[model samples]
Target chain A: MGRVVVEVMPKPEILDPQGKAVVGALPRLGFTQFVGVRQGKRFELEVEGDVTPEILAAARQAAETMLSNPIIEDVVNVFEAEVSA
Target chain B: MGRVVVEVMPKPEILDPQGKAVVGALPRLGFTQFVGVRQGKRFELEVEGDVTPEILAAARQAAETMLSNPIIEDVVNVFEAEVSA
Candidate 1:
């Protein structure tokens, strides 16, 4: 088995209201150093196959095409790991 | 400087409409996976300070409290690295 992890986020130029809210809330949480916060999403998938480079590439393409919004968001990172038997 | 990367995802029990849609779209992209897709986010912050354990902890706490929705989502992973000068 293989595990794929993806992180998706709004493009830097786009306004992120959720990010803004979180940034506003930070002072209440005792973290006042950050000038801003940008919110995003993370996905972890378990592929029922060997962890091969091909599988990783396919999954990443799937992520880019279907899982993320190219107009407003981007896939920032992709990580894959072998599932130990 | 330091870099912080966070992955945020919805709780397993919660319904994920976006994930479902992506899962449905994958076959068209030639990925006939076993089943399902869950979407999430990633954040990379360039912290302006010394790269210390304390800074990392503070950033993590900030993520957990303000950035992530504890009621519906969880912070799955946190990674910190020193920014190369």
Candidate 2:
């Protein structure tokens, strides 16, 4: 089978409280080397057969419409992968 | 300067109710072609300067310990990126 990965992330200008929380907590845990942290979501779609180029397009479309709010979010990537079971 | 992306996904054997819910909702929205759906988290770390190998290791360590529950989740990728902002 094939899989498609859609990574949805907040727009750079948007405020990400969850991400900010992680960034804030990191310093207390002695991970103070980072400048910023942005948290996002990843969706893996498993298709029954081989993934066509068209499937990638459809997956991106679905992700934009269903998985992410385009007004404040964006899809970072939509890529296909080969998988078994 | 540089960025690191950490993808944390649930173990294959784990039951992800959130992912299942999305899968169930898809069919109702006329997206019944998929077999399964898995959801995960993505962490983007923005560093000040160049991303050395040591930076990658530290980011991975931080991600494993604080960003994810390693017992039930797996890090799929920890790769560096080039970014302007």
Score each candidate by Cα lDDT: 0.71, 0.88
- Give stretches of model 2 more than 4 Å off: none
Model 2: per-residue Cα lDDT over B1-85, one tens digit each:
7898889999899998879988888877777667789999999998888888999999989988998998999888899975856
Poorly placed runs, candidate 1 (over 4 Å): A82-85, B81-85
Every candidate's fraction of true contacts kept comes to 0.53, 0.78
Q: Over the stretch A1-85, how does candidate 2's per-residue lDDT look in tens digits?
A: 7898889999999999989999999899988778899999999998888888877877877898888999999998899965744
Which has the greatest lDDT?
A: 2
Alpha-carbon error at B69 in model 2, in Å? 0.4
Please give the DockQ score of every candidate, comma-separated.
Answer: 0.53, 0.84
lDDT of 1 by residue, B10-77 (tens): 77898978778767777776788626567766666556665467767887886687667899887876
Q: Per-residue lDDT for A1-85 in model 1, tens only?
A: 6678766778889999887876677778787666656677776666776657877787788668866789998887677844432
lDDT of 2: 0.88
TM-score of chain A of each: 0.87, 0.93
Query: In model 2 chain B, which range of ten residues has the least summed lDDT?
Result: B26-35
